[model samples]
Target: AGTVNPLLLFDEIDKLAYDVHGDPAAAMLEVLDSAQNNSFTDHFLELPYDLSQCLLMTTANDADRIPGPLRDRMELIEVPSYLFDEKMEIARRHLLPRQMEKNGLKRTNLRVDDRCLMRLIEGYTREAGVRQLERVLGSVCRKAACEVVEGRQRVQLSLARITEWLGPVKYRQEPAAAEERIGAVTGLAWTPVGGETLEIEVSAMPGKGHLQLTGQLGDVMQESARAALTYVRAHAAALGVEPDCFDKIDVHIHVPEGAVPKDGPSAGIAMMTALASALSGVPVRAGLAMTGEITLRGHVLPIGGLREKLLAAVRAGITTVLLPGKNRDSLHDVPQQVLDALRITFVNEARDVLEHALAQSPVQDGGAVLPDGEAGHAAVCH
Candidate 1:
C-alpha cells in the first residue's frame, strides 16, 4: 500500500487485468498521483502516512500493450529499432572482427563480404534491431572457426550461400500471379524494413457498377478506392468511355496475400488506373508502375517510396514508369542504369497517366507506320 510503503515497482504493469471485478491498478491512481496522494484514504491499511512519499516506477516491453487510460498517466520514452546499415556498422566495427579475434581465427582465415552481410540481414534475420543479427553472425563465426580449425584456409559467403547455411531466405518478394491480366497492377509499398511489391487486382462481372473489396484493406485504403472510382466516373466522358460503364459492371478490387493487412491512400491512383484499364478494354502499359492517391478532383497526390518503387518496377522488367509529379525530387536518387533503361513519366492528373499507361500498337515489321495511339497490346513496357 502506498500509505504504508515508501516505494513501489510495477513490472509488467501493462498486463494488469481489468473488468467489473476490479482493476487494482486503477484503484491505485490516487496513491500514485503525487498531487492528490497526501489526501488519499487507504481502506486496505488504516495508516495515514503521506502517499506522495512513495517512489513509483513502472516498466513495460511494448507501450502499445498498456491500457490507454493507464498509459496516459506515465511518461513514455521510445527506443527506435536499428537499420541494416547500422547493424553492418556495429558488426564491422565491433561484432565480427571482435568475434574473429576472440575465437582465435585470423582475418585471412575467414571473411564475409558486404553482400554476405546484406544477405544475413535480409534473409536470415527479420528484426528492427541487430540483437538477432549479432547472434546469427556469431553462429556464422563459430562455423567459420570450425572450418579453419580443420583444413579450410579461407571462406566467403554469398547471398545464395547464406540461404544454404540459414536454410532459406526469410524474405523474398511474393511471386506475382502467373497470369498478368488487364486489371491488375503491381505496386511497391515501403515499410520500416524495406519495400514490398503488392499485387493489386481488379475484376469486373456483368452487374451494377458496385465496388466490392477483399484482402483485408484498411478503412483509409477502402476510402481511397472509393475516391478513385468517383474520380474515374466523373472523367468518363473525357477518357473516351461510357458514363454507365461502372454503373453496368460490378467491380471487385483485391490486394493479394490476405494474411498481411495493408492501408494508406497511396495506392488509390494505381487502383483507379487498373480498374479503368479493365473496364475500358485497355491494358495497363506492361511494366509501367504507378503510385499515389486520387480524389474526386482527379489530382494525383504524391506517395512515398519513389526510389524503392522505381527499383521494384525495374526489377520486374518494367521500362516505362509513371510517378506522381510531386515526387520529381526523388528522381535524382534513382540509378542511372534504371533511368537509361526505363522511360519515366511524371504526371499530376489521372488523364496524363492514362495516356502513357495504355499499350500503343507497335509498328509491325515491313508494314505501314502505326499511328500514335494504335500500339497493339504489348505487355513489355520496357
Candidate 2:
C-alpha cells in the first residue's frame, strides 16, 4: 500500500506544526516533489517506495500563512466568496431539498420561497460560504417537521415567518444610509466575507498644517490619504480651493467602523473626493460610490475586487460608481442586472473622478478654467 499510488489530502496545511520534533512541511517537500518522489524512503519502514504517481492536494483558509517554499511548489487557485444571488440559488436548488429529507419532512409539506430565502440570507446570516445557510435551512425544516407532526398539514415560509423563527435579524443590510454632504464620501471595500460600503470623512480645523488619519487605518491606507491630499493641494488653484488652506488648517480623514482594521489603496479616490469637498465646501453627489488608487500625478490606478465592490454598491442603493478606466475590461464579470441598476463611469485621471463625484464644479468660485485645448494637455500629463 505504501508503494501504491494514492491521493493524499492535507487540510489546514498553513497550520502544520514545527518544533524540535522536526518540520512536517519540510518533510512534505520531498514527498511532493514529482521528480524526486519516485524513490522516496520512509524512516519507519526503512524501505524505498514509489510515490511519484501519488496526487497531492492541500487547503488553507489563508494562503499567506502557508510557508513560502511550500506555496511556491503548487499552483494557487483563489476561490472567491459566493455572491448573494449565488447563495439564493444554492439554497433553493440544493440546501432546501437536502434539509427537508434530513429533517423527515416531505417536500410538499415544507416549502421555502425565494423571498424567504433572501430574507434569511440578508437578515439571519452573514458569511462568505453556505455552511451557516445550510444550518439555518435545516433549522427551518426541523420547525416545519414539528408543526406537521402536531397536525398542521403544511407550512409555507415567508419573510415574516422567517423573522419569527430566527428571533431577530443578525445583520444590517446597509451599514448606513448615503448622505449628501461636504467632506464625506462613500467608498467600496472588499472583505473576506463580501463587499461593503465604507465612508471616508474629511474635516478641516484651525491648526498646524498636518493630516490626521484615524479609524485604525493601516499604513497603506494612510499613505493613500496623504497622496490624495497632495494631489488636491497641487491642483488647488484649478480646483478653486484657497492656496493657503492646508497651510493654515489641519485636515482629519476618518473611515467609519473604527474597530475593524482597514488597509488598502483602493480608497484613494474616495479620500481625494472627501478632502476636495471639505476644502471647496462642495458636497459630493448623493448615492455615488467609488474605489480606485491614485498616483501623485493624479492618475487613477486599477484595483481588485471590482465584482464584489460593485455588488456592494448596488446593495447600498448607490446610483453611480466611479472606477478606473483600466477596470472597464472587467465589467463583463459583473451581472447585467447590477450594471443596469448603477451608472458606472470609468475614469483615467483624478480630475474625472472629481468631475463625477462632486455635485458641482470645485472651480465655481470664479477660478481660471482650463481652456478646451489644455484638456488634452492635462490628459497628457496624467
Candidate 3:
C-alpha cells in the first residue's frame, strides 16, 4: 500500500518510557523534525523512506512532561476539555449512532433521551475528554441489545433506568461551603487531567512559633506557603493581627486528600488568607474561590490554566472568584455562561484579594483601619 501522503497520529507520546533501554524522546525528535526525517529509514530494512511528505500529529495529556528539545520542534496548541453541553451534543450526534450500529440495533430499537444521556455523563463518568462518555454509551447500547434479544421488541432508557443499567454513581463533585469558615479557604488547582477545587485549612496552637505544612504538598507549594506566611507576618499590623502573635503560636496548614500529591504556586493567596483568618479570627466568605501567585511584597501574579480553573470553580458551586488582574484578558477563553454565573473580581495586590474574598475586614474592633477606596472592587488593571 504505497500511499503518497498518509496521515499519522502518535497518541499519548508523553507517556513514552524512559530508561537505559532507549531514548524515546530523542527518537521522536528525529521523526518529527522535517529537516532530518526526509531520509529516515526503518532499521530492520536498509531502505530510506521520505517521511517528510506525511502529515504527523502527536498528543499528550501533560504538555510540561514533553522533552524541551522535542517540544521546541513542534508547534504547541492546547485543547481545552469539553463541557457538559458539548459532551451531550457529541454523544447525540456521533457516539450514540456509532454504538447503535456496532451493537446491531436499529435506530428505532433503543431510545435514550437527553435526560438519560446527561445522567450517564454526570454520574457514570468523569474525564477531560468524551472517551469515557462514549464507552458508557456503548455499554448502554450493549445492554439494550441484550434486552432486544431476550424478547423485548424495543427499549427506552429513562433517567431511573440509567442508574440500574450502570452501577452506582462513580463520581461526585465536592460541594461548596454554605457559610463562612475561619482559617479555611477554597483554592483552584490545575492538574494534568483537569482542574479541581482545593480546600486549604489552617490551625494555630500555642507554641514557640513553628510553621507546619501538610497534605503531601510538593516543593513549590511548600515554598508558596512560606511566602504567604511571610507576607502575613510582614503586614500583621495592617491585617489586625498582633505583631508578636505568631511568635507565641504554632501554625499548621493542610490541604485535603493527603494521599494525592499537590504542588503549584497558584495557591499563594489562599494560603495567606487562611493564615490571616486563623490569626485574626476573621472568617473567609463561603462560595468564594481564588487562584493566583503572590510575592513577598503582596502583589498578585498571573497563573496558568485559567479556563480550566474557572470551570472547576463553577462546578464546585462557587459564586465568586478572585483572579489576578493580569489574567483578566485570559477570560475570553472561558465560556460566557460560566463567566456570567459567578462574580469575578480581578486584583493586582494581595490586599485587594482579601478585600474581595474575605467576608469582612480582618480588623478586630477596628484595631487596624483601612484607607478609603480600598474597600470595594479593585480597578481593572491592563
Question: Which of candidates 1 and 2 reaches a greater TM-score?
Answer: 2
Top lDDT hit: 3
Model 1 TM-score, 2 decimals:
0.63
Relative to the true structure, candidate 3 has a C-alpha RMSD (angstroms) of: 5.6
Stretches of candidate 2 off by over 4 Å are 1-3, 12-24, 39-49, 149-151, 175-179, 362-382
Q: What is the TM-score of each candidate against the true structure?
A: 0.63, 0.84, 0.90
Ranking by lDDT: 3, 2, 1
Per-residue CA lDDT of model 1 for 142-251, tens digit only, reads 78888888889998866666666667776664444444357788766655444557778887776766789999999999999888778767765444455655666677
What does the lDDT come to for candidate 3?
0.85
Ten residues in sequence with the least summed lDDT for candidate 3:
373-382
Cα deviation in Å at residue 10, candidate 2?
3.3
Indicate whether candidate 1 or candidate 3 has the larger lDDT: 3
Candidate 3's TM-score = 0.90
Candidate 2 per-residue C-alpha lDDT over 25-70 given as tens digits, one digit per residue, 9 for 90 to 100: 8777877778778988888898998888888888886687889888
Specify the highest-TM-score model's number: 3
